[model samples]
Target chain A: MTVTCPDLSVEIAGLHLQNPVMSASGTFGYGVEYEPYLDLSQLGAIVTKAVTLEPREGNPQPRVRETPAGMLNAIGLQNPGAEVFIDDKLPALQRFGVPVIVNISGRSVEEFARLAEMLSIDGVDALEVNISCPNVQEEGMTFGVDCDMTGRLTEAVCAATDLPVIVKLSPNVTDITVIARAAEQAGADALSLINTLLGMSIDVERRLPHLGNVTGGLSGPAVRPVAVRMIYEVARAVDLPLIGMGGVMNAGDALELILAGATGVAVGTANFVEPAAMHQVIDGIAAYCRRHDVARIADLVGAVAADQA
Target chain B: MPRATAILRHREEVVSGHYLLTLDCPEVAKAAQPGQFVHLRIGDGTDPLLRRPFSILLAQPETGEVQILVRTVGRGTGIIATHDEGVAYDLLGPLGNGWEAPAGGEDVVLVAGGIGVAPLIFFADGLRLMERQPYVRSIFGAANQEALVCWTEFAARCDEFTAVTEDGSAGETGLVTDVLAPELERDRPQHVYACGPDGMLAAVARICRDAGVPCYVSMEQWMGCGVGACLGCAVPASAGGYVRVCADGPVFDATEIDWERMKRR
Candidate 1:
């Protein structure tokens, strides 16, 4: 009976999840667009694309390019603004019964706080703060790369809302764990890492960048090892629970992160390859638990052994 | 909207570097419309990560078959170009909205450039079975006659077809717009449909705009999810901001797009 029924439930930052797999922000478009391909109610959670205070047109075409074992996208956070997101996109997702984790971006700490206050509605479960956008007040410095800014931004957002705040850390930084620790110390409820690695591709023949934005974020299998390393480091440095994501494709890849310290794993680029990938990851996690005699998936979080022998 | 593992019924070399793949997917074929596409997982590997989008060239629901034209221009297409028959493909389809055809009788002109002809062929085939067929004339262009994929089959399906090659290797030694200009003057076509490189589409859009004819263009973009979820395939819209080529359309009114401002990579 234990082998046949292994519990896949997980609790991260005070929210109960059916499983560990959630849609990575920017990759999953508000959860409703994928309705034709997969069942939404079965997902662990739905993380939306980045939402801003005002409507954004986003980067020009071409926005994506298929690279080795991965793909690069410079979507530039195109969204219908916060009001449209809550009024239009959120209502459709309310019926899915899955938690709606809204990923947000802002140019200033005030904007971040304002967004948090406005989005603290009945249906919203949490806030995944995307610290990737440039800080207009800081002379174009990225908030995630600056330790002091990250902490201040995290504190501002946490203070503005009652919902759990998950600060998504960027991998482009020299020390991601430092940023992760900064968020934890600043009252952040959770930390999600690593965001897509900054990478670029060139069209040698035409002497032009493949993406219109020139450099784009790299995601898929190519970034899994880096994601695991970052999660491992952040897990050790910070007391907050971690939502690990970056190139997560299947259960095994997800488990690798869970073992590294991620309580919840978000599937990003893989959703583009297979729309129903999160379901497979969830199913595979169950099979993995049953096979290993692990009764519940939460037991596997940060389960990696220090010594292999 | 089914995620199907479609099997390859057959593969044919339409021309050098261009191949036709017939897939056995009942759900996709049964629901397939002209100008819509299928996203194909290239291989059982991640090196070429994103699924490649190929516009449907033909759909035979009775046979549960759909076909795509693959030009070996990149690693993804190269993989499919050499794939053997009977191999199963991880597929997602009848994805995105199909072309909105003319309601009934209208003077419609289809302008295709090279493999951009694929979806137009599907459109032509679809028009034949419609209750009222439009007066269709097509103009196909290629770098050269040898590079041209299909104009004969397109000619058979339409009321009239014109072929153009840059070097005069086949028909008119000029662009599709060269023929379209005189054709537009000959009878002021009611509607124009086009697909090809961005430059060609832009030129065609200009002609249609000048002639005050409604034009529909099937755009090609670097796509992530063929579904609208990713919002990766963005094209500039005239109404301000961007529209997704994958969702808002692989097909859109020429006027809906702000072509002058678009920087298509």
Candidate 2:
């Protein structure tokens, strides 16, 4: 009898992934920056930072602050605009031999639609519609808060692009499941749950807010439980594949999301702590599969027992 | 660059709240340039989850050692200050762009304040390694004499060194900028490299601009990934838009930065 390798491949909607681990958007800059440290081809996919309609300067100085067990960032969607991203970043990203998922954000439904249409080039594999940028003052988390707006924006983006669309949901709402179901109904191919929760810190000595933007998105191990909880609920609510992320630092954290019903896992804050963290998560998952005698990594998704629940 | 666990060869409190940590890591030291920094993981646990970035104060590639001058500003640095010798730190670096020295024999001035003196020491050391020594002048300032660090080291590398304190406890009684203004007027240096508080950098940039002297400043921001990916270390460019300090530069031409916007933070 031949012992075959465990299959780590996953398919989110129509996009086939070699593995389930990919770098979270904003954390991995165009997949070109981390090439010196880790092989980008080893991961499942690369999620580019949120590209806007025009070049944005983002927020003022002090855009990030480290909190206990995590960090808060108010990097207000700074990018070289969609055109520059396509002209400059996309060409380099295409060379990595991995699927490049472009993350796009806008102030309005028309802007999101326009971005989706513009980014529908050959080199781009998919589009991660980011309706949950907490740092931006206007239009970022606005679409994500309301169910109707989320559905409308998702529908507009999906109609604009032929590429598989993944709607990234914000956790700042009252109920995440409502928005998750709305995105699914709006024809989103898949969903990415729990984009950092909004939070702020005060510098008592200076009597000022820690982040330039009064509030920032909270990420890291501190938000892991919240991500898992949101993923668990949304996974049960929607039939669409879910890309789960919050503060995944290692393989164990990745597995937690997978077992909680995430079809794919994204490494965000961990990339800051360890540049090659996504590779380690990929290897750890493989090791776990062999230890448990699991034939395929896909079998581990939503495998949480009722008693464990 | 490769990530390695470097042993803490030396740890000393050089000032009231500042600690100098020396690590024995061959891989990092060999690749480190003057203005590049190391991202250090303070402890084994994930309480303070993110790695704190520190400018490489000294890099001795031959001896496989690198030094980081850390000021105890917060809980993360506080934790780092308490560690003794023999502690191992997970470091990923010599990340970001370093200071590019001007052609040999040109006059060079280095300005530093408080903990900002860290990277300048490395820059001054690199100058010494050159065949021709530039007319090096260094101006360092602190709240008082006790806060001043590495003046002796600066003296060895620099042809002339000026130390300033707010309380008249050191070389001069006023700001380092006070010395810089007159010096630029007397004989403008070809290049000025500065790493200090935002206020100091802004002042230096203005003086250099008025004097028609090129200035390079190492910016400090709350960084996420020491690489370009995070965009956490965004600094407004004078021309327009923002640039990542971690990627575009920790060291940037003075004219490139929007000094007014930078000082607001």
Candidate 3:
């Protein structure tokens, strides 16, 4: 009846992870917030909240609302900016056992590069480029949809730091493969696909929008199918290591991303619904491995049959 | 508190919209106080990502089982409700402080609205076991008689039980607080424990404040990370600050909470 920790460890972009159980960027704030509830040491790595070149207060109140199968959020990348993150947050994450991946957003290519440069601290293990923020008028959605812009931004960020760079893609695109390929061609060490989908909710009684921002990115279980498809498409288009996410609540969901070509998976909206879901998923993966008699979970990656090619 | 390695033993549909999930954790059950909750991961298949927070409805020490009563309000709970029994679920809990009963010679008042009764039942059990002969009284309000779940279990424990229905379909007419007002005058309990919809708790707080009775109110919030990561469940306090419902409290002193700010128009 003795239970030993499973070797669900993974290496993404040279960053060693204890396991593949990671909390998504927006859902997990700076890796310091959830410390009181559960031990941070049990996680693979902590992805800080999406940071920018300067501090952002985020969208107005009612930033989130419950939808049919998921939820919509217009947080507007609320963070203390890149300088503050490195000065205050990054050092704190270093004390924990796992690596810290800083998720950064920007208004322009130089902004991203500047933020990336600042994040090149001693403790920061990697950078997750958040190119899907829709509220920021200048850089977010605009840079993510176009392959050329994505390439330019990716190259700029990759050049600015020695830390592994993970380009987190937007699901609001028709051809997600184009952006994935562009990030790979631009020297991105890894890829994380399927950020929140663009969506909104309305209050019929009040004749107004449910959220203060009027529009937000849809997340949670509702976006799982779209995320799965996008991850699968990106998997086919790129050869780099992929971290797939979007409504991943269980080991089977995490496995779906791996089969779709993801090397790792992050749980986002599920964190809000259940705080201990990440640990559950990690343990669930181990149980699945034991049941299937598989020695390693990494073997499940890209195991799905290629249909078109 | 002993950290028992608990596993999700089973998930079963109890009432129409509610689920009864059992976690096999002997230590947690032994250490768990009434009103504390367990944060749970819902699905084995992964689609909805997040752990839903459910009140620790019952914990059986001998059975090594802890029960969570969940009313499915979103995808996360729905996912959990549909799970096949015996599937393992990750759990982190016996979390958030619970209501501690008053000292000897003090009467205990229990107020519940609908599923809010889940935690109060445990509170009653603790009181009865302590041999306090705690002057137990319960007033519950529900949308209708059918929604008034587990009334008999609590009624049998309490010295007196009053049920209220908004639509007048069951028990007395009008809100449960209306029934509580007359009962409070008659029982004159020194302390009160309540859980229910936001409006009901606020009303209970207001009543307790005016009556000079101390009350403990369990609040609910739209949680992001139930363990306090996402900062989604922030409840304003009377002390000019915000306390996280998942961390600082799913339980708080009625008089200490900012009732004005909690009421969403």
Candidate 4:
């Protein structure tokens, strides 16, 4: 039987996702938090938080603060480390019946390799090397801003893990596509761009940085345009599949990512605003297909040619 | 687990500064408790990503109406206030553990600071409806007289109500804690309930600690997922580490909270 609503299913880095709407790392916990709020089975995949070589308690107080149309967070990647994730979090994620993409961050190149090696053990669908995190004291923005380092690190993780590797790019770079191209050259199976743009909010009265860490990554509707522009640019520069996300709040926004050449979209800051927003976006995509007389969801991917009106 | 549709039924601009939004989500209203809250969707698109959180001011199940008192302080709240009535507003709710009202015939002390009074309003009403002859006292504070929103309703219901303004425009001059200082010393309330800005709650928690009385204070946090998952809305607890404000509480026992760390935040 032919699928009625154009096939929205997308395959990224060997993971056969039924759709392209994955939950962004750090937004959706290992896959349990939304169980009480929404059905996790509907999502393309659930990306766990940035897993480290060892457990981290994260940053100090005032980890988060609200900004204009966005928010600044310096969580410092407080995760249960890679072992705990593989041992504890992965089993729980398996029950969701969706692919699980493990997001790994590191303080050094070796740490990234170690995390990748550990995550390669079963249960994970892909490895999203998070070179986008801006909280740590070292190696946060370093690898992302320099295309050469990004390429070097992506290759390290690719060599460490047997699973498909998707390098998450940072938006803080001067040219995001430069790093995207580098990751592709380094053997990354796919790319997830762009991570939160570097930002900070000041408490005028206190005359101090609003977030615990002086600066934080900015996310939400405020950064969508920047993310989309970067994703479109990166899409043309690299041939690998793209996972586009930044302040995506609806199905139309998800569609925009696909048209801009993203093979999938991750729902991030949108979860903070509304828990069930991703499911709604999924339904909206189906309705959009019917309205546009489209047969398959995959047909819309990269369909907006440069000559289009 | 209810795949319930939360439609924006009515959006009333209550007072110039706050919007009294009503969501027609029957499951949420039916399942809602006294101190629970809902996460609201912002903007028609994802540009202003993240859901804004608001405590449940009132949930009328008979009418399928759940109300949220939103103060337009930022982009999310501003977007929520401007949402047109009849449009669909996405919401995930009736989440978080609520305040535990006195069982019966117990003197109650209610304290609110600025917009903090929003969530506790329903709790006070619930106490009065129980007909427990509660020696109710409400100590509220605001920057000035104009910032106070529900003083009239609080006064009519509370057995003894005291309003404190920073500039001495309304009631007591110093702070809500100053007004409550004497009450704890003289009246010695059996149980206390409080909600307000963090600074005020910190002071209230200290007072409760000094008096050796039990207190429940509702907390506010900028959350990602209002459910227990994201751990974005965690507040440090005296027990250790952090507690999810959306799941473990918006209402936490005063003594159980880590006031020292929260003050720093």
The number of the candidate with the highest lDDT is 2
**Angstrom error at residue B232, model 3:** 5.0
Give Cα-based local distance difference scores for all models.
Answer: 0.88, 0.90, 0.79, 0.81
In model 2 chain A, the worst 10-residue window by lDDT is A1-10
> Candidate 3 on A1-309: residue-level lDDT in tens?
322444577878888787787889888887776665567888888888888888776554456677766777776776667778878878889888788888999889999999899889788889999887776677788989999999999999999999999999998888898889999999999998788888988878778887666898888878888888888888778888889898886888888888887888998887665556788888898887777766666777788887665
Give lDDT tens digits, candidate 4, residues A1-309.
Answer: 434556678788778888889888888877787777688899988888888998877765567776666778777787777778778778988887888898989988999998898888768889998988888878767888888889889999989988999999899877887888889999999999878888888888889887767888888778888877887888888889989988788898888888888889998877767667789989888888877877777778777676766
- Candidate 2: stretches off by over 4 Å: A1-4, A307-309
Give, for candidate 1 chain B, the lowest lDDT window spanning 10 residues: B146-155
Q: Which one wins by DockQ: 1 or 2?
A: 1
Candidate with better TM-score, 1 vs 4: 1
Better of 1 and 3 by DockQ: 1
How well does each candidate superpose onto the true structure, as a TM-score?
A: 0.97, 0.97, 0.71, 0.87
Better of 3 and 4 by lDDT: 4
Indicate whether candidate 1 or candidate 3 has the larger lDDT. Answer: 1
Q: Report the error of model 2 at residue A4, Å.
A: 6.3
User: For residues B1-265, what per-residue lDDT tens digits would candidate 1 score against the true structure?
Assistant: 5678799989999789989888999989898899999889977778788899999999999999999999998988887887898899988888878899788888799999999999999999988888889899999999898777977778889998889999999999989989998899999988999999999999999999998988999999889987887888989999999999988999999999999978853
Q: Interface RMSD, all models, one decimal each?
A: 1.0, 1.2, 4.4, 2.6
Against the hidden true structure, what lDDT does model 2 obtain?
0.90
lDDT of 2 by residue, A89-170 (tens): 9999877788889999998999999999999999999999998988887787999999999999999999999999999999
Ten contiguous residues with the weakest lDDT in model 4 chain A: A1-10
Native contacts recovered, each model: 0.94, 0.90, 0.28, 0.41
